[model samples]
Target: MKHPVTPDGRYFVVRGRLWRMSNPKLDETQRSKLTNRLMSARRAVRAAKTANDQSAEAAAHRAVDDAKRVLGERGPVWWNDGSPDLNRHLAKNTPYAEWYGQIGRSRPGGT
Candidate 1:
């Protein structure tokens, strides 16, 4: 399912938490390549877990980390606005609280 992105495009909200978005400045081709690599690494992690191979899992995890870092998802904040990175922070506790609250209120049966 698609998640809601913040107005500044710096993050997307999932389960009421903010997750940093990738660098929007990245060219489409480069983004696609990095995304593909990230997916492959994720699959490798699952395969290693299913095979009960701890070493392989560790290596796969590293690969995943590397892919994410390069994609600007897990390392430094991609925005250059000097804003503090709020990745993984609960939306209700962050600057997005008011906006997130409006989202819930706009949805049917939302409280």
Candidate 2:
């Protein structure tokens, strides 16, 4: 299911927590490449787990991290405004609290 993105576009909310988005400035080609790499790394991680290879799993995890860093989904905030990286924080505990509340109230069956 698609999650809600904050108005600023810096993050998308999932289960009420903020997750950073990829850098909007990245060239399409580069973004696609990095995303592909990330997927491959994830597959490798699954394979390693299935094979019970601890070292390979660790390396795959690192590769996934590297790709995410390059994609601007991790590491640092991609926006230039110097806003604190609130990624992984609950929306109710951040500046997005009111917005998140409004979303819930607007949804069907929302309290």
Candidate 3:
């Protein structure tokens, strides 16, 4: 949960991993509007309780998804680099496997 944004604020580091994040395609006004809406949706999701709130939460989640897409954090990537998206995999299992293992002892139970 420690997501520290990089100096340029274009990426955030979590658990020793840097995740690409940027939304240059969105103007300040538009981005702020979407961001506010997304925050409201997230709050709604957290406060959900009644049966109707389930559907409300789902709608809120959709709003968040849309906002993220517009912000270039979801859908297609913001960068033009040809490298494959490795965000979904752990460094220990991806191309960085060897490097990660070299810095630490093996995990318990062979994981």
Residue by residue across 1-111, what tens digits does model 2's lDDT show?
278889999899877899999999999999999999999999999999999999999999999999999999999778888799999999999999999999867867542
Best by lDDT: 2
lDDT for each residue of candidate 3 in 2-111, tens digit (9 for 90 to 100):
44444444455445464657577778898888888778877777776444678887887887788777777777777666655555455555555565455334433232
Quote the positional error of residue 67 for candidate 3 in Å: 0.9
Candidate 2's TM-score reads 0.93
Each model's TM-score, in the order given?
0.93, 0.93, 0.62
Candidate 1: what lDDT? 0.88
List residue ranges in candidate 3 displaced over 4 A. 1-10, 49-52, 88-111
Position 60, candidate 3: lDDT: 76
> Can you rank all candidates by lDDT, best first?
2, 1, 3
Ranking by TM-score: 2, 1, 3
lDDT tens digits by residue: candidate 1, 1-111: 277788888888887889888888899999999999999999999999999999999999999999888888889888778999899999899898898899867766543
The true-versus-predicted C-alpha distance at residue 70 of model 1, in Å, is 0.9
Q: Candidate 1, which segments miss by more than 4 Å at Cα?
A: 108-111
Worst 10 residues of 3 by lDDT: 102-111
Off by over 4 Å in 2: 109-111
Taken over the whole model, the C-alpha lDDT of each candidate is: 0.88, 0.92, 0.63
